[model samples]
Target: MAKPRRGVQFQHRGSNHHNGRRPSISESDSVSEPGSPTGAAMNGKLETSKEEDESPPQSEYEKKKQNFITRAIWTLVMMAAFFTAMFSGHLYIIAIITGIQVMSFKEVIAIANVPSRAKNLRFTRSLNWYFLGTTMYFLYGESVIYYFKHIVLVDKVLLPFATHHRFISFMLYVIGFVFFVGSLQKGHYRFQFTQFAWTHMALYLIVVQAHFVMNNIFEGMIWFFLPASLVITNDIFAYICGIAFGRTQLIKLSPKKTVEGFVGAWVCTIFFGFAMTNVLMRYKYFICPVNDLGANIFTGLECTPNPVFIPQAYHIPSIVTDIPLPGSLHIPSIVHVAPMQFHILVFATFASLIAPFGGFFASGLKRTFKVKDFGESIPGHGGITDRMDCQFIMGFFAFMYYQSFIAVYKANVGDVIQTAIQGLDHEEMVEVVKGLSKHLVNQGVVQETVLECWTGVVGNRR
Candidate 1:
């Protein structure tokens, strides 16, 4: 290579340099990139950037850690609420539920693909109706209790209720439902808040009263936890099964929900219902009894009877009496007796079956809304309603079951004579029956032949 061009740089190789060993870098520097000092600095920069840009992608472990931490926090907050509801009970729950309802309603109204112009009006009406519904609920509950304590044991309104109260309550519920469904309606969806408001008021009034009656009767947390447990458990088990091995689509509407999930969920529901039925019914131990209501609305057996024979005295033995100072105490029996076994099973089975219907109904509603998730409020899950939508449906169903099935009390002399005395007496019931028989006879509807059905149905239902 003619001894190569020697300077600060050199091409050193085997003696057969012409065979091409080229240049080599050393402490003195022989590379062609730049000056030794400058090159070192530039290499440092390049290496640093390479390190920065090409650092290993976050490990799956790290991503999972972040996700877990996030979900844990969320779960903790929600679990706290549930625990509080379990502990603090009805009043607190009512507050929590009301707030949740408001939020759910707002979300529904805002998200529905309705015209912009109608949004304000619909939203206003929905809000108005929400307050109205809540007000009606409070009034209905108070009125029912008040009347129940004073009048004949009937539905929430009062004794001798004409079709007027029934119709009004029904109309309220219908109106509330309308406000929602009307808002959801497409094409002919005019967002008629007036009609919606009226219907909801009617329907919800009846339903709320019914809800109170059911909870009051059943000496359990069935009204609260029954629906929540069934629906939530169904959803949870279904998802778990679906994720593990999903095959056939459960529904054309939500293709992601599989038949495997449905079966798993349904089975889970039965087991859950059976197990929770007892637990939830027993949970009444933690709740404050509102009145002399029985373990369940229908049974009319006071679960927490006003602490009869309270141990107000401390007994002394003969030895203590002899001592004249020290005394040994004898404790009296203390118990919080529940209703009959049949009553518990009756409430449990009824709530159990009704709960599933509520879940199915929710699924149908979700399908109607064409949504997989209601909102992103809960990461790794969905909205509160998305999580609890089925519970609401189930609650309504249980409430209706309670009202339709358990609300009325046809007295037997020994069942709850005391409670009956507070409400309807035999004389009043006989009078109502008499009035109905006469009215029907005058109308020529029964010809006095079928007056029994008229009084039974009319006197009871109305």
Candidate 2:
């Protein structure tokens, strides 16, 4: 047979051309077959190129549309959760706020602990968390003491802690500070101290503001609900208005925000705020303070509604109306507007105008860190801090606004009962009743005969 091809000679083993075997092909003469290593690599590259060509990349518009849809769905879910919590009870809302606080703290701490800066530090991470715990304890303790003092003080276990909460909080902080200082290294001092400042700032901004939000809840659900609702409403309207008519950029800090959007949102928010307040004021569940820990939507609560919730008749001024009423005839227009409407307008204004600054501040923070979002905790919504940046500021402002303008001091019977029972022993309580009876008799609020009958009943019980 003709000499076998050099590369194919291996298949004809025993019949050799030289020394019972075919001569090996020279490296220059060898040709790569389709199944060879070089051929397989070329095939793989061709397949990869085909795949890249077949699948088109997503355009910017498509990406934005997908993001918007995702955000809208999650926003609806969040709204559902908020309304469910609002209807559940004040305690449920408090729980939600507390959850938010913890998550926000975690996100902020993660941002502060950059790998390069935190790698050399030994105690920085531990100290940061310790300080967070200490600060949360102090801030949350203050809120509990102020809002739920009755319940806290009456519990024997909680009373001592509640009484010395400030001192205990300070001691806890001091211990952490001492540990932090003791563990400091020569080269890592700057990073450790920077982290220390960052931790406290996060605590103040996140925890302290959130405490005021809880305070707003206790003051009355309306105080919490209306301001929160206004902010949500403003955010929605602002986005809508921005997309529809936005032209001039409002601020450098937030490039997307627009002057038209800002103004339009304010007008729409004011109207929405007024309308929502009108509706919510009619429901005692939405307007009442959480006096009972166990109170819920099912059980309901009863209270003399705040004067703001009560509609008052105001005589219409004749300045705008062409028709003049006779001086003798006092024409009173039966206006069904709540006094809270005026205050809601103020809140709406802030939600539309000033609250956006909080978002701008967050935007600046993200820019400084060169991050797209604070964290990817909320899918399309960025992070909890991003969503709540404006809210904490708004909630704090609502608390201050209520305290300054709208709050009225009304004696609550539950408060009085708690105070009387908290510190008094059985004998002391009996003496208090006796003293109260005599005082009532002296004030003509109780009869001597009634006092005698009460005393006899007490004696029989003993």
User: Highest lDDT among the candidates is held by which one?
Assistant: 2
Compared with the true structure, the alpha-carbon lDDT of candidate 2 equals 0.83
Query: What's every prediction's RMSD, in angstroms?
Result: 17.2, 7.8
- Count the clashes in each prediction: 28, 0
TM-score of structure candidate 2: 0.80
**Among these predicted structures, which one has the highest TM-score?**
2
- Model 1, 1-462: lDDT tens digits are 467565544446444234556644442252345567867776687679879998998999999898788878888888898666555544455556656665555444444535654554446455555655655555555444443433343434444342144566566666755656645644444555443454354335334433443454233344456555656666778789889878998666556778887777676667666566445444334332444332232332334422211223344555645543335654333433343222334444444444445445546766777776657777755665555544555566555654554343455332343344445766775665677678878898768766766567656855
Over 4 Å off, model 2: 1-49, 321-336, 413-430, 437-462
Give the lDDT of residue 367 in candidate 1: 71
